[model samples]
Target chain A: MLRELFNSENSVLYHVGKFVMWQKEIYKKPENWSMYYKEIVRQMYDIGIGSLTIVMIISLFIGAVTAVQFSYQLSGGLIPEYYIGYVVRDMTIIELAATITCLVLAGKVGSNMAAEIGGMRQKEHIDAMEVMGVNTSAYIIMPKIIAAIIVIPLLVSLSAIVGIMGGYLASIATGSVTEADYIKGLRSFFVPYNVLMMYVKAFVFAFILTSVSCYQGYFVKGGSIELGEASTRAVVYSDILILVADFIIALVLTS
Target chain B: MIRVEKIHKSFGEQEVLKGIDFTFETGKTNLIIGKSGAGKTVLLKLLVGLMKPTKGKVWYDKLDFVNLSKEELQSLRMDVGMLFQGNALFDSLTVEENIRFPLDMFSKKMSIDEKQERVNTCLAKVELEGVNHKYPSEISGGMQKRVGIARAIVLNPKYLFCDEPNSGLDPKTAITIDELISNITKEFNITTVINTHDMNSVMEIGENICLLHQGKLAWQGSKEAVLDSSNETLTDFIFASPFLKKLRNAAAG
Candidate 1:
């Protein structure tokens, strides 16, 4: 029991230390920030752009299913048919679009980051950096963090727009809602505070994904199995932490 | 000069280096040689600050490495260069960029042209001209090793550390690497240290040799003395293989 408890506590402390190291690395200027930027852009294209189609398809189906389910349930209620749009827009943007979508993106982006870095670690590229007097954290982790910071907001924005439109199209096609009434309903429920909350969650989710995955990769020991385990754990832990963080933020910000 | 004093390192229950005490002098190829699992690599890592010794100190000239802060360590690292066993070139970087990496890190005031010139100079030193645009994967193993060597010496470091510099090369290429290291050490007059199990290396360019047997200093001497040494263990080690015994015979002849 003590061994198990110690293992758990060690994992917690390891994660906390990893976050501190990542934060410290963010402000340290590397030899060539431009090269780092270009690398980040390349990764952004691979992680963000390449994964866009999958995220879009998932978001679309989710929006359509949510609208159809809501319309079927609320058809006989006092709430008008146009409230479908309100439900779709508000729910997708505030919760599903911002949080659930990010959870999925984290699985893609975060795991890949972990695996790539972990592979480099296994292959001794990070050791090469140390031998060359290049700070591995500054050179390797910075580009990744900066890339996630730049690309995540843009991805969240895209998901929001696509998901809302998917719901809008599904609702109008089913004859359960009209475009004008849906637009009016969406407008009525719109709040600047909700949008601000979405952005905040997006930013935090980005940090959680990049920092955790990079940390898992950074500390990878042993060989191939260890790297795969690190990537798998990175995705699982980041997903759970994103949900927990979202709830806390929702509680604080909604109050 | 690099000095390791009573250095000890352990991994959990297993101790790698018992009490390695040695001094690597300037302007020569100082080699650490031993059988596999004899703590040669661990001692080299301790000397280069790759890993901290569990029970002693490593010093560069007069500065004690154990007492240095992280910032001081970084400063010390700036004046040292290491070529890893695997020729760990960044796969993502091109040859020119790889050579220029150190210059970019430590010399901000250097113009791009000056950096390019330096890169070319280092590349030329390794006889790898016009291959700057190619990625590391595009290069041959020997070429990649040369690129690794170029990057190691690009900074004109006062201290050079190489771990198993010729492990994967053919005999001819290994000889070239050994000769290149000796020439660079002589030309730059830097304190160069190499760790190798390759007896060819021990015979070829080992100006100063430190033999480790199960983590203790077995013997220290020059390459010429290596063949005539009367130490039973050293003789057994040098003549253990037919190829090495033949080479020793040839040297004697």
Candidate 2:
């Protein structure tokens, strides 16, 4: 009879409230600065270097596909050939590079974070740390989130560059655009504001993916099967939230 | 010493610990024994501040644990050390790193050389010397358990909690762990509490015992009291097998 009033924990609003409240725990002063520094370095290496190859691969393919499709669309229209380069560059910078790259990372880095933390939770490592007076939330979650915030933006930038190059190579190789025309298009309508938008989206998506994933793993209970579910949910929720945030960011930033 | 004043814990509709009032004495191996699902783990967690009580207060000496602020709780937790049921050694870290983690995290005044020396000293204490660089998976189960002990005592904590320290070990290793815990507690003069169902642990190093039955304290006393007490719950738990009953009868005769 008394449980229902206090325990509508299943609602989405409840989880959001909990997540918002949990932020305070994550922002507490560290027990030792050097320890957090070391952890941040380790997490930086793992999240940055670990996902580099996959990010580059997906970015290249996305760039190539965008260029090819844009060329085909422009063929029947009065749009100039160089507009392919302009469209690909703006598209990669404003949306594709940030969104797709993070979505991929949501699968790669997000799931990995979930499994690592979930495994620690199952093994009682988190409890052991808690007993030692280390802020498990700060020590565990902050490093990953910080590292992601720093590196994911850098990764998105790289993805943008690689994607542009992919567009160049795909269009020129397929006789869709000449090198001179493509180069001219790349130089045309270049907006520095689009670059800022990319960074904004990168920062937002990075926070979403890492924080959401870490949250899923941190609060996990029960056994191996539950751990697996948490890992999957980390990726799933991260992707969904990324898309939603992308829409909202697009609305706000473009407005 | 840690004292629970009228502690009661419940999970939704089910109450797991019903008014468990007890004090775990300092420098003694205080054991909480019970059958599976009898709430030994729940009680241990409550004592360690991992879980809060549904009602009543947990007193860690002069401090009230239930009402401690976040910073205060963390401050209090620094003096606490625990050996989890699975040892809970960090798999990614080397054995030395695992043991040295608390020191590394909290011991800002210590030099790297001092930290290394302390880690080595703890290893030697656990008789796990020379395996510093090896990960937890590379070591044997008993050795892992010792590494867990080494990690727990790295800070020379004032309060030590062990939850099933002998859950998976063989008899010989279990005895060794029990002796180590007992010695550590006495040497450091720290209040030690153990939650376990291992009878061997109960008879060997259980200077103080707490037997929980269906979330209530069924029996509490010294290790010597187990042999003389005619408590049905304790008897049924200790002499559940006929072989043990026969041995008890023969010894009595």
Candidate 3:
């Protein structure tokens, strides 16, 4: 009984420690850049292409809803009506569109990658690769990480455009702001820095999303039960880490 | 040549292998057989450097396998081939890709044509010539096992380790796998180490049988000698389980 308890305890510690080892392994070989790039392309298709429609639809609605809310309040003279255009563009594109879109992606792409790779690990394909002289790091993890990086940036850009368009439609319908003024408001703050910050956040989020999900999947144990557990843990952990990473990046960019 | 010297391995306090000492030679099938939980599997893992021994050293010729550097281990791994019990073929790769996988990773000198030729040759060796494009899922369990064997030997490894090569196969297919392994061992002159609980395998390809019992080497001899050995523990072990006893009885009859 004591021995079984110790074995389980040891196994838990080993898995946690193995996860950290996998994280460190990412930087162990810089020569794997090209392989990683190819992997990213594959992942990009899954993350971006698969989830494009939903992200776009959600972005548009968020933009329209925000514009409608702002138009109602701004017409009463508590705030200038021109500010409605700014609120729609800035809040939708800069904050809500970029960050929240990624949060949604964390559930979709992150969980999918986790479940797929977790299933592979549980089935022992990963060990089979190692036996055949194939590098597991290059053969498995590199592709997923690369795909996420390529896909997330494109998804972010798509969400930003759709969100602004949604705001334009809502503003036009409500008669709170003219189309020219809405276009002007978007062009006015076209701060290269703001655009650059969005790109930075997308890239960082992609890296975290892929890495954490892959890590959770790669180390999953037992049978179907552990796989289900891994999938859940991957989504939850990646979601939390994405928020934390976004906050850190936001602090860095703003300061 | 593979040399295991006084190897001790334990999973917690269970002590799966206690002082295992054996040498597997080239061009012969070395079989490790025992009842379940007799440490045959653990010993196989140790031989292949998958699981490290607690109190001994395994020398692949001169290099201490346990203490080798990562790069060294990777290099050594190139010389080794392993067939898992479940025929652990990668579901993502087709049989052709799986066979060519090691060649792509370890050999950059070969042209694509050369690689393809080698894959065909290996596929042919396992009698799986035209089924190259099939995925593990698309193939039968026996075919998957053959593909697993094809993949293992694709690199033309110096040492071949099989963990229950016939675990789930029918008796006919299982015997065929044993014969195939034996033929390959002779043809390539590779040091082939097999871990099995099958008495059929023990009688057929077991050029040297190491019977392990409760984490100890209960007996070690050839198939001919195994029949006449006076060790009571070995007899009880061989005839202990009903399945093996039935096999032995049928063979005698």
Residue runs of model 1 more than 4 Å from their true location after superposition = A1-11, A14-22, A25-47, B242-253
Give DockQ for candidates 1 onward, in order: 0.54, 0.85, 0.46
**For residues B28-70, what per-residue lDDT tens digits would candidate 2 score against the true structure?**
9999999999999999999998899999899999999999998
Question: Taking the tens digit of each residue's C-alpha lDDT, what string does model 3 give over B4-31?
Answer: 8999998778888999888888888999
Candidate 3, residue A86: the lDDT equals: 74
Q: A98 in model 2: Cα distance from truth in Å?
A: 0.5
lDDT of each: 0.85, 0.92, 0.82
lDDT of 2 at A152: 97
**Candidate 2 deviant stretches above 4 angstroms:** A1-6
Best by TM-score: 2
Q: Write the per-residue lDDT of candidate 1 for residues A1-255, one digit (tens) a residue.
A: 655544463667655755775678656867677667777888778767877887798788778878889999988899888888888888888888778777987788889889989988877778767866677888788877777777887788788888888888888898788889778767876887888888899889988888888888888998998899999989999999899999999999988
Query: Which has the greatest lDDT?
Result: 2
| Model 3, backbone clash pairs (residues 3+ apart or across chains), number | 5
Ranking by lDDT: 2, 1, 3
Ranking by DockQ: 2, 1, 3
User: Candidate 1 lDDT, tens digit per residue, B31-65?
Assistant: 99888999998888777767888998888999998
List TM-scores for all candidates, in order.
Answer: 0.93, 0.97, 0.90
Q: List the residue pairs that clash in candidate 1.
A: none
